[model samples]
Target: MNVGLGLPVDDPAALLTWAKRADAGPFSTLGLLDRLVYDNPEPLVTLAALAGATSRIRLQTEVLIAPVHRTALLAKQTATLDRLSGGRFTLGIGVGGRADDFLATGLDVHTRGRRLDEQMSQLRRVWAGDAYGEGAGPIGPAPSRPGGPEVLFGGFAPAAIRRVARWGDGFLGAALPPRFMDRLFRDVEASWKEAGRPGRPRLVAQTNVVLGPDAVVEDARRNLARYYAFTGNAAHFVDGLLTTPGRIREAVTGFTEIGADEVMLYCWAGDPGQIDRLAAALHG
Candidate 1:
């Protein structure tokens, strides 16, 4: 399976430096996460900057919350990024779990799932150059790839899986345990088949890592705690951080064994050197 790196969105200097290093490294993809009312940089805008900075690495949003944005605008931005990146962008989208994010966007949190469903359909139509109304012409700078970037849907719910089968090209699994992934992989396969989709859905798994000395590990733990504090159990994520090469390798192997086509290692701390350390560990 191919390995990818998740860009740290909290620090601007570190994020840009890491993006450059990742583009030059052996990593197959560089990914970002999305959140409103957070310190992290906006995913799409960050990606556009990285697109200008790098040439080879595939760019992705680990999972962009689709329900909060206007469908046409999202489609336009995604298509623009895909074209700007020379067709190296893959869009992973979901109905985000944070109620505050929805509230901040002034969107109804309860209608997220339905909103994402409708948005995905509209996204396809927008990317296809279909006129929105009688007079409007197609959106410009069409996606470099046919039908826009590959859309990967992320969520563990039955409705989410159904949406994946219907509209998504892949499944994006984030920070899920192996047992859960086993079940999820099976469900994705079953759903795809039941939907009469022609081929198996691409499966991608993501998790955070913190590999270095004790100081680095502790820093990562603290950062993770702050990042996931909204979840009410930051320690749960902190405890799961990969602090050793052995642990990172084990996680990668385990995910690959369960049929993940790509595994993205997200760095918890904003240390730019973490990229080289991770690259060495993966290669070593």
Candidate 2:
């Protein structure tokens, strides 16, 4: 399995440094998190900057909230980013669970799932050169990849699995436990087969990691608490933080055993040096 690093979206300067190092490091991809109501930078815009900064590392929005954005605009932005990155972008999308984000975006929280379904289909159609209305032709410039970037759906629900089978190219597994991930992976494969997709869907798993001294562990826990505070269980997330090399290794091995194509480690602290620590832990 390949390893990737998630960008620290809260600090713009630190994120840029991390992006550059990730490009030069042993990591396979650079991942981003999205939240409109948060301090984090917008994933697509950040990715465009990273595309200009780095050449080799693949970029992914660990899961962009699809229900909040206009379908065609999102499609155009993604296609443009994919082209700019030379086809090194993957669209990991989901109907986000944050009600505050929905309210802020003037979107109905209850209709998110249905809206996501419609949006995913529309994104594909727009990417496939389908004409809009009367005057607008297909959205351009065309995606670097034929049908746009590889679409990966996040969330582990029956509906999410069905959506992946129908419109996505892969599954993006977020910070779930190992046993849960095992079942989720099985369900994804079953759903893909049931949907008559030709091959197994790609699976990517995400987890949080903090390395270096004890201060770094505290920083990670504090940052995680702030990021997940909206969930009302920030302590739950902080409690699961991986602070040691052994824990990180164990997490990586477990994900790989459960058929993850890639394991993305999201750094909780806003420090660029975290990438080097992670690389040393995994590769050295």
Candidate 3:
């Protein structure tokens, strides 16, 4: 299975250093997480810098919250970044649930799904045309890719799956049960077939992965804590689910079996040394 690495870093120089060493050629793609108040740089700005620093590694936004920003402006920014990266950008978008973010933007989280749907429709229209005017066509500074950056929408619910079918070029799976992953894929495939779409869209799943027997227990616990915290799940359950390197491999293999085209493993390492060890194991 194709594997990508997503490292959430707080420092731009550290991010740059990681990208440069990444020229070692192990990861298929590298992604940045999008969260404004998390003491992290903005995803597109970081990726714009990455596009300049690296030549071949694919750059991704593991997801940008669509409801918080204007759709046309977001598409333009993404297209410009994609142009700079020579079409190596994949725009992963989702409706984020952070209450602070919503409060900051003064957007209603209750209407996020409907707002995203409208925004996506408007984005496609604006990307495909010039202005919403008569004399204009083809937006200036178009993306290096013919139809703009590939859109990867993420969510696990049935409604979410349908939204992806309607607008996204692929589905990005969050932390979901194995059986539910199967159901999600099935729904997507059925949606494509029903729509008479020619080929299946890409499917990428993200999960926390541990790579060593010598890995620090505290780091693993912290990783589980953050993972569970995001899902509102209790961190205690993850210890039994992914306690060993063998268990990690088994879970990945199971995801592959369920039609995951690529698996992007969040190294789950909070310390510096853990990064190298995790990458080495992923490369191996």
lDDT of 1 by residue, 117-178 (tens): 88877788878888754677677568998887999998889998898899999898887866
How would you encode candidate 2's per-residue C-alpha lDDT over 1-284 as one tens digit per residue? 69999877667767778888889988999999888888888999999999899999999998899899988799899999999999999999998988989999899999999999988777888888887547877878789999889999999679998988999999999888676798989999999999899979999999888997878778888889998898899898898888888889999999999999999998888767788889888964
Model 3: per-residue lDDT, tens digit, 41-121? 788988999889899888888878888887767878888998999889999898887776777788898898899989887
Cα misplacement distance, residue 99 of candidate 3 (Å): 2.1
Error (Å) of candidate 2 at residue 272 is 1.3
lDDT of each: 0.87, 0.88, 0.73
Listed per model in order, the count of residue pairs whose N, CA or C atoms clash below 3 Å is 0, 0, 0
lDDT of 3: 0.73
Q: Evaluated with TM-score, which candidate comes out highest?
A: 2
Off by over 4 Å in 3: 132-139, 177-179, 212-217, 223-244, 270-276
Return whichever of 1 and 2 wins on TM-score: 2
Candidate 3 is scored at a TM of 0.87
lDDT agreement of model 2 with the native: 0.88
Model 2 stretches astray by more than 4 angstroms: none
